[model samples]
Target chain A: DTAVSQTPKYLVTQMGNDKSIKCEQNLGHDTMYWYKQDSKKFLKIMFSYNNKELIINETVPNRFSPKSPDKAHLNLHINSLELGDSAVYFCASKLRDGETQYFGPGTRLLVL
Target chain B: QQQVKQSPQSLIVQKGGISIINCAYENTAFDYFPWYQQFPGKGPALLIAIRPDVSEKKEGRFTISFNKSAKQFSLHIMDSQPGDSATYFCAASTLGGSEKLVFGKGMKLTVNP
Candidate 1:
């Protein structure tokens, strides 16, 4: 069984469009995070959720919103996506702070 | 601002050779440091990690050397195999704080057979 999984491994959309990428983890981790890897392969944390509560929002634009309906699910919804938003989005989960984080297979988003 | 800085954006090593990647962090409070390996079309996996308590930690052919005073750490792969070729990212985070990991730019290692 896959430990951490993401939906729509690849996404292609036009500018000004809206899309959502889903993430789920079965490791029973309490902390879930969203990261963006740009073209240069620079990984940066976008948001983090713990027990369905927002813990950290790393100054991401207002167009991006992260929703965690439950402990096992965290989804990223991008509104009015732009070209700069094209990148690989990764979801990670950890059982607790100061623990190992397991990552999902990432979703590649392309905005034309 | 890149909090964690990595050296040698890319490297090529021969099989059975040693591959070294260095990283430095600006935060002095970081307590948890980890090195992640990523293959093509895959997510980054934790290869090895070391905290400040121990100067070095080894897991098979993978080793992590850390220096708390210098705030620097490095990953050494011994007898690197072709399968070891991938992108390596060094990350640092204060587990006691927000637990947000700050990653380096990433270094691509190509092991030639």
Candidate 2:
């Protein structure tokens, strides 16, 4: 069984469009995170949710918002997506705070 | 400010050779260090990890060597095979902080048979 899974492995949309990516973890982890990998392959943390609480919010633009309905799911919603938003968005989950994280397959987002 | 810095952005190794990737962190507060491996079109997976208390940890052909004093760590792949070709990332995190992991740029390793 997949410990972490993401829906819509690939997303292609036009500018000014809003889109959402869903992530789910079955490892019973309390902490879930969202990371963005740019074209240079530089991975940076965007947000982290622990037990449905927002624990970390990096220097991301306001257009990018992360919502966690429960401890097992964390979804990313992008508003008025721009071309610069084109990158791979990854979902990761840790068993607990400050522990190893397991990543999902990743969703490739391309904003035209 | 880049907290973690990795060296040799790309490397090529022959089969049965040893591949080494180095990383240095500026934050002394970081206590947990982990190495992740990623293949094309996939997310990275944790390969191994180490704490500041230990100098080295080994699992199979992959080993992590850490130097707390120098604030440096490295991942060594022994007997590297073609299947081992992938991108490796080094990350660090603090204990009580936001628990946000700081990742290095990443190093692409190509092992040729």
Candidate 3:
């Protein structure tokens, strides 16, 4: 079984459309993260949640929001997406503050 | 500012040769350094990791060399095989608190048979 999983492996949408990506982890981890990988393959952190509490919020645009319903799940919602938002979004999970992270396959978002 | 900077965006090595990827971080608080391996259409996986206190760590054919004072780390693959070809990323995290990892751009390594 996949430890970490994300839904909608591929998403294609038009500009001004809103989309959401769901992530779930069964590793019994307390922290979850969202990362964005651009065309250049530069991966950057977008948001992080520890025990369902927001911890790190990078300088990402306000259009992106992360919601953690529990310690096992964290979802990302993008509003009014633009062409620049097209990228591969990854979901990762860690046991706590000291454990290594396990990542999901990743969701590819395409905006036209 | 790029907290973690990786060099040689891509590398090609012979099947039996050694492959090395280097990374440098500016933060002194970073205590844990990890190297992640990623294949096409797959997410990055934890390959090996090292702490500032340790000078080097090894697992199988993979080795991680770390220099605390220099704030630099590197991953070396010995007897590299064609199956070892993949994109590798270096990441750093603090001791406590958020522990949000900062990853380098990435290094694509190709081991030619």
The number of the candidate with the highest TM-score is: 1
Candidate 2 lDDT tens digits, A1-112: 9999998899999999999999999999999999999999999999999999998899899999999999999999999999999999999998774478899999999998
lDDT tens digits by residue: candidate 3, A1-112: 9999999999999999999999999999999999999998888889999999998999999999999999999999999999999999999998874569999999999999
Error of 1 at A74 (Å): 0.3
Interface RMSD of 3: 1.2
List iRMS for all predictions.
0.9, 1.1, 1.2
Q: Write candidate 1's Cα lDDT for A1-112 as tens digits.
A: 9899999999999999999999999999989999999999999999999999999999999999999999999999999999999999999999774468899999999999
Clashing residue pairs in candidate 2 (N, C-alpha, C atoms within 3 angstroms): none
Task: Tell me the TM-score of model 1.
Answer: 0.99
What overall lDDT, based on C-alpha atoms, would model 1 receive against the true structure? 0.95
For model 2, give the RMSD to the true fold: 0.9
- For candidate 2, what is the TM-score? 0.98
Candidate 1 off by > 4 Å? none
TM-score of chain A of 1: 0.98
lDDT per residue for candidate 1 within B1-113, as digits (tens), equals: 88999998999999999999999999898999999999988999999988899999999999999998999999999999999999999999988679988999999999999
User: Candidate 1 i-RMS (Å)?
Assistant: 0.9
For model 3, the superposed segments whose C-alpha errors exceed 4 Å read none
Task: State the DockQ, from 0 to 1, for candidate 3.
Answer: 0.81
Q: lDDT value for candidate 3?
A: 0.93
Query: Looking at candidate 3, what is the lDDT of residue B19?
Result: 94
Q: For candidate 2, lDDT tens digit of each residue in B1-113?
A: 99999999999999999999999999999999999999999999999999899999999999999998899999999999999999999999986677778999999999999
